[model samples]
Target: MTHDHDHDHHDNDLDPMAARVRALETILTRKGLVDAAAIDAIVETYETKVGPRNGAHVVVKAWSDPAFADWLRRDATAAIASLGYAGRQGEHMQAVFNTAETHNLVVCTLCSCYPWSVLGLPPVWYKAPPYRSRAVLDPRGVLAEFGLVLPEGQKVRVWDSTAELRYLVIPMQPEGTEGWSEDRLAKLVSRDSMIGTAVALAPEAA
Candidate 1:
């Protein structure tokens, strides 16, 4: 999957915030106060062009360079900024690395506070109350909904993003890529993986 390119997986209005936004969009569109096409175009740009590619490159670099990965572990904001990915909504960042025994998941229970600079705009589901509440209460079940069924023994750590800080999940690099370049490896890094809803793509999948 390429932003692990999925945005249409769900269309639930599970929260008052989300429902209100949809209602406002409808009202605005009806009143000609906003252009629905333009709105879609902007969301599409963020979903496809802005965030996923830059985040993928960061993941690839971490996968390729141990020194950089160490720096990322120590100072994620600086490490990510070093790659020129820092901007509004991403000033404070923390990188949580996934391992064989552990997995990471992120959500904003209060609101959709996300690392927009790195992950682009938060997906609709991420902002909905169902996902926000369920991610913390039933992280494994949420992952299963995203098609990521972790092993029973694998620890699932849930991180809550707030107004001041956000988290990026550093997915485990795929295997059998010893001789591959960063660019090639980036192809295997999906946005969903960085979001911790899924794993990095398999080489064959890439």
Candidate 2:
């Protein structure tokens, strides 16, 4: 459940959205409008059971099997569903592939409509207004902020996620992974890669 991202400080600090959610839960529980235990169970499910690991599995499979990659590109919802990763926030899915000439980025311009079924709870930064607006207005700048500097000629294409549909970025396979197994490849797939803020890890890095 641990991640190596620079935002590890978030683990120590109470996320702003989480603080708001807790306040709302308190109000709802006090008014008897919501079950506190039920809410806790749901949170536990996402925190423990559903997470980036699920999305990594999908990414690794696509990397190892070209046919699966084609199917994911054609019918992401069904292809992802076939892997048992379909649920709320991931009903309608679209897979965008990262290639040598183009990089893909995902953002929910209106709100944080993320693929919770695959990637678990949305990160606090993902729901921030700055990321939402800038991702659409200046994707290259946003990637730079994430420390991902794309090639000069590589185009950045941003996808806006909606309530009805969500997007997953298929990062290009890294080099020196010619015959890597799916399990090993999955280790190289990070949550940011699927979100397109980063790319798959290099073999040595993994």
Candidate 3:
């Protein structure tokens, strides 16, 4: 059941599972039961199986080890596999660096293209047409809107994602974490950092 597509255009073909989702939605809407339970089941499908928990492991590992973080920022796919969270879209991910010099941003132009292996199903706002259109055009403004105003000297590089290689942001380590172990450090890393909203914080700082 592992069907690999050789041609890029082949991806556009109807995924039977997705077609089934549409069919189910149509049935539910017709039956007047597109309620909270239906949504919950759909959310569970992605959260438990298709979304980004795998990618989160990479973020946690990177947060703990400076060397591993460096390796990850250089080649995320391999670095993640080094720690064993390699599968699905993450198999070909390219970690984008958001630093004092260049800040990276991710948005799915056509849809909410995200690194679900680590981050989980994108929040509703991420798929909103407004965020998709505006985040790319005005990244600084968007970040500010999200209450993430960088210092005046930093540069920003907003990256729009295609279906082929997903992206994740590696937030900078917080201060006061001088001699923390990787396990302790991992706890400080949050999904927000991977999704590029908040930065990571050390325990003492937190």
Candidate 4:
């Protein structure tokens, strides 16, 4: 490859993050801990995360109030907005509830279109090609990859997110707590749970 023209842009000229990445990559490569070619391959496959607090609140409310849950089911965008959380990438939202017989998984097959307002940021793996394809082709297998194994008779349904719409999974309420407070229940909702890669944690686990 030709580096003749690029050398004019020195390390100091690079952006802070770019400079740091270059430095780290060089250090790892020289130490034999990483291969530069492997690093390139990783970069080639990667396309493009946040805390799930907002989505957790939505899940908590759904678990605590039946009316809100019904509203979420009928119209997730307006329901989520009712709680004062609405913005770009979350304009059109759909809530898929996980039931005893069925599980739901969300993926953006085209690109990383996510419900940022509610779910925060999309995970890096969510933007990768393998997950986008396999999510729809083999959702159960994908869930198992995330360490969630559904029962034999249970079915897995994949929701494909697009530029205009996104999905949020409402996992079933865990057992052993009939009157758990919303705050307590919120703790049981993992980011992955709302993504449908896993179920809500049980009370003991929570």
Candidate 5:
């Protein structure tokens, strides 16, 4: 399974933590304490079988079904579990909707308490101190850094994720996508959008 490390733009420069992880993996593999093939299988499962695609399906269902959207808002855990996307750091889920008036942003102030079941591993930046600190202190500024500039009148709501509960941001459906199929709509739902770092991709953008 191929890991999607593209989220880290600094692919050429490994951070200390990443370097340590790689070193540990190498040591374990060399010592026969870990099976490299098993590790690859697990990573592949999360990357291809259970990553952002699951979140995209959830978003598409919410976009196509108003009742599901209401249910998701009322009980995100049960709603998401209903779609067979519940596990680990995603046992308790909260779905936050982004509207014209309000934009939702999620951050784990203490550590990275991300919903790995649906979004796969947390991006490096999501676990970085700068994002964790500024996501709450200067959400607009942080969003701007991600190239998502919200309107001045729009209210930014920052949700702090915890070990007990994880937050998923349901971005607003893009315009000019009327009559589109759920599969097509799902294509526009990006991992960053679910994390509130970016909005759903525009039809033309795709």
Candidate 6:
């Protein structure tokens, strides 16, 4: 922690991994093996069709309709396809509940295995080792740190993600959303809702 040298460089000034990627790109271009179009296609596919926005739509529909919610909780993949946004990573998903009695926590111990179809990119903190390690062992304490303290006697279950099935948090619908359309309701389903850290946004907030 000693900073005696007058080298004017903050610790945040350098991201070694990004710099390495840039170097690799230069090397690849010099070797004439990089295909920019292929990379663009892959990025576009994930950004548009394969990410969490698709999941958000499904969650919204489920919120607006009771039957859809039952189906989603039972079989998320098929339930999601009931609306047409079904393929790839979303082929297998499990909707976990966060109720008054039990709080469900999700973490990928080895890597960030998120329900991308509903939740965009995983937040930096979600991929942090501290969260992955502590979320399972002390769920209540971890939630408390995120400003979500549960009532007394509430239980918590943390699901460690694997390759077989993805996980999404089915947050309780916020108050004052009666008689809203599926499109309007979908707008309130933020990424945090799927992550279980925050409740769904109220329709009025939109």
Give all TM-scores, in the order shown. Answer: 0.76, 0.82, 0.70, 0.77, 0.79, 0.75
Each prediction's Cα lDDT score? 0.87, 0.90, 0.73, 0.85, 0.92, 0.75
lDDT for each residue of candidate 5 in 9-81, tens digit (9 for 90 to 100): 7667678999999999999999999988899998888777878888999999999999999999999999999
Q: What digit string (tens of lDDT, one per residue) describes model 6 on residues 1-206?
A: 57676688654544789888878877887798886776678789777766656767777777777898898888877886677755454348888876778766788888888776567668999999999888877877778888776678867777887767778887767778877787777788777667766667756677
Task: Please say which candidate is ahead in lDDT: 3 or 5.
Answer: 5
* Residue-level lDDT tens digits of model 4 in 77-148: 999999877764436999999999999999999989888777777889998999999999889889889999
Task: Sort by lDDT, best first.
Answer: 5, 2, 1, 4, 6, 3
What is the Cα-based TM-score of model 1? 0.76
Question: What lDDT, from 0 to 1, does candidate 4 have?
Answer: 0.85
lDDT head-to-head 1 vs 2, winner:
2
lDDT of 2 by residue, 111-192 (tens): 8999887899888889999999999999999999999999999999999999998988889999989898888889999999
Model 3: residue 157 alpha-carbon error in angstroms: 1.1
Error of 3 at 143 (Å): 1.1
* All models, RMSD in angstroms: 10.7, 9.3, 13.0, 10.6, 8.7, 5.9
The regions of model 5 sitting more than 4 angstroms off are 1-44
Full-model lDDT, candidate 5: 0.92
TM-score for predicted model 6 compared with the true structure: 0.75
Model 3 regions lying over 4 Å from their true place: 1-45, 49-56, 89-91, 202-205
Cα deviation in Å at residue 199, candidate 2?
0.7
The clash count for each model shown is 3, 0, 8, 0, 0, 6
lDDT of 2: 0.90
Instruction: Judge candidate 6 at residue 194 and give its lDDT.
Output: 75
